[model samples]
Target: MSQQPPAQQQSHPGETGQMQPRPRDEMADYTGRDLLADKKALVSGGDSGIGRAVCAAFAKEGADVAIGYLSEDSDAEHTAELVRRQNRRSLQIRGDVADEQHCHDMVDKTVREFGRIDVLVVHAATQEPVSDFTELSTEQLRRTYEVNVFGAFWTVRAAAPHLAPDASIVITGSVNGLRGNKTLIDYATSKAAVHNLTYSLAQHYMQDGIRVNCVAPGPVWTPLIPSTLGEEKVEGFGEQAPMGRAADPDEIAPSYVFFASNRLSSYYTGEVLAPTGGEIQAG
Candidate 1:
């Protein structure tokens, strides 16, 4: 794959099939060693991008999965197919994560299907970039926080009672969260709130032996890019990073796998693992 994607654009909440250079989100070449054998996971936004890769990786590791997505039925079905191919059960629940009831329903359906939740991945997010802060609208700000921050809160709260010791909750933050983005004002702020939520939740769940962590990645070739960013911005998406290129969903997924597996991250919680393509950040 090339380091840069050609200039392209798509409607909001883009479909993976419509992407010019399809995202590498299937985890196709990866092999599993039953790291998540018999476990069950619920991944919000599991239809595409990082969420799609995470679902594939978890299935390969021997876990049944329930995918929560919005209106992207085709993408969600394709993701479920990937999981089913691994002989793991997959349940697709389509609804907007921004809806409080929907978030709760996502967890409820996953528990009903799998009987319990071993992993909860809060990866559903929305972003729109504005060249100037003045162009950022109140509506956009509310929507961004509703999906990126509020949804994460609702999903985790609903899943809390069902999570036991050794259960893991992984929130998807962004490099922009640690260091702000000039154009992505609302999105960056929402993600920063999410990172803080991971820290707070980790402390709250520590006594119960449940781990909470975050994976904040740099630019990754995902549907969200071409859909939300301007055509020009999508052209050289991750060039600002020290690596001068964006990551593939495949490259970013292993971080989620590590956080999901207790055997690998037993002593880690409230940690933010940033795969920023060499962009260094200071605490």
Candidate 2:
């Protein structure tokens, strides 16, 4: 297992370079078998962390990529470089996924550049920890839900028309969604909604030959951890996991690739794959 340093905090919407023990998001050693040959993919929050890894993985599998993020131009450019290194076209779209118009624009720009979208990975999310449930403010709750829940809805809806048959939709859920988290109340609730949305959308689009699925991960060493969880929680981040350490973004990425590839997950729809360091939860 990989080792992570003690906790370090950053401002909201953290940068990957600012993170200590930088997350292994490059997908360096992964080899692909053209599972997504010539496919076009749009990934929200694709600038860093799990999204960055997923973009690289998709590119390695022969898919061109379009990344949408709030700002993070540098990180987005870097991710695009990685995709280009794999000889795939990369389009970088900057805007907040929480904005409905921005979501529509993201889809329009991506489709214009890539011709079509074969995979849509809604990985962008935001969270603010409230030490106590009562400490959660109305604004914080709304912001969290806006980005984590509604953002997914707006993004998917905007992209839905452009997605062709056999297209795949992958949503990033969390272990916190399956079971409540005392500290991450708003974040957990949003993710829970996303999980159910994945199920509902799977049924809604099944007739169109579209597949929807989710990957609910446990503690992952991403910029989101320190940025949202704070110093103390970051220090021993994944110790509670049976694996004793948070997973690297590189480690969590393959689950996305699996769901994105029809050759691998043809019969799977509305499924939640938990890569949670041995943590178990009932359905």
Candidate 3:
């Protein structure tokens, strides 16, 4: 593997605040009506990007939040600061989702802090170079799977027992999962597995009063773009999309909001909400 220093420094897992063009995290113009009033949410990868937007949405909807992230303390603090602006309680847990034990600790800590869990959002993922297939080393593949698949699995496993009846679990999938990313084979494959896992879990847990669903986003301009892609690629991202722009994290976040609130989508489960800005294909 060759190391070429990124044009804009990397925010490893990802962040919205530091993105080259800065993703719109807040739905500044959107008004809220307390959709998730008094609800409790536990979100993974909640430090920034779509996860950060979702955190803000949860807070705006009147839900206190417990967030988990992978070693991004500053980013996590920034998210918590934003959550607090909405007047909701926020707890930031720093740890790696790839570790099963860490996942357990996150859930346990959330319950200990918040007393119960009403919604669980798995929004963490990993993707390498979208055009460098042959360069994906075995270690890279393992790391990708560990974060994207194994991490999600451990999250659900740990949170299952703590999930309240009628609780919803939203896992973040990607358009790449639906339409394979040749540049991100391992990452894409893991997301595909997440989609299937969401479906299977929904059906398997339907009778248990748990709803497992997925949200697949396309072309959202999060910090990952500037970090993972070369400088040139980041310059004109949204231009290639049919919507003529990379999605703002705020735009993609409402899907999670819809899936999280049982009142809005009580009858929906095991399904996916694709927020791809008119992208015909999904992942």
lDDT of 3 by residue, 1-283 (tens): 0122234646465555565556677666556679988889999999888888899888889899998988778878888987788899999999999898999999999999988899999998777774666788999999999999999999999999999998999999988889887777998899999999999999999998788899998887776777677676666666666777778888888898899998888999999778877888623
Expressed as tens digits, the lDDT of each residue in 1-283 for candidate 2 is 3675686998878889998788899999999999999999999999999999999999999999999988898989999999999999999999998788999999999999988899999999998888888999999998999899999999999999999799999999999999989999999999999999999999999999999999999988887888787688889889899988889999999999999999999999999999999997886
Per-residue error (Å), model 3, residue 26: 2.5
Model 2, global lDDT:
0.93
Each model's backbone clash number: 0, 1, 7
lDDT of 1 by residue, 100-135 (tens): 999999999999999999999999999998988999
What C-alpha lDDT do the candidate models reach, one value each?
0.94, 0.93, 0.84
C-alpha RMSD in Å of predicted model 1 compared with the true structure: 0.8
For model 1, the stretches where C-alpha displacement exceeds 4 angstroms are 1-3
Alpha-carbon runs more than 4 Å astray in model 3: 1-11, 14-17, 130-132
**TM-score per candidate, in order?**
0.98, 0.98, 0.93
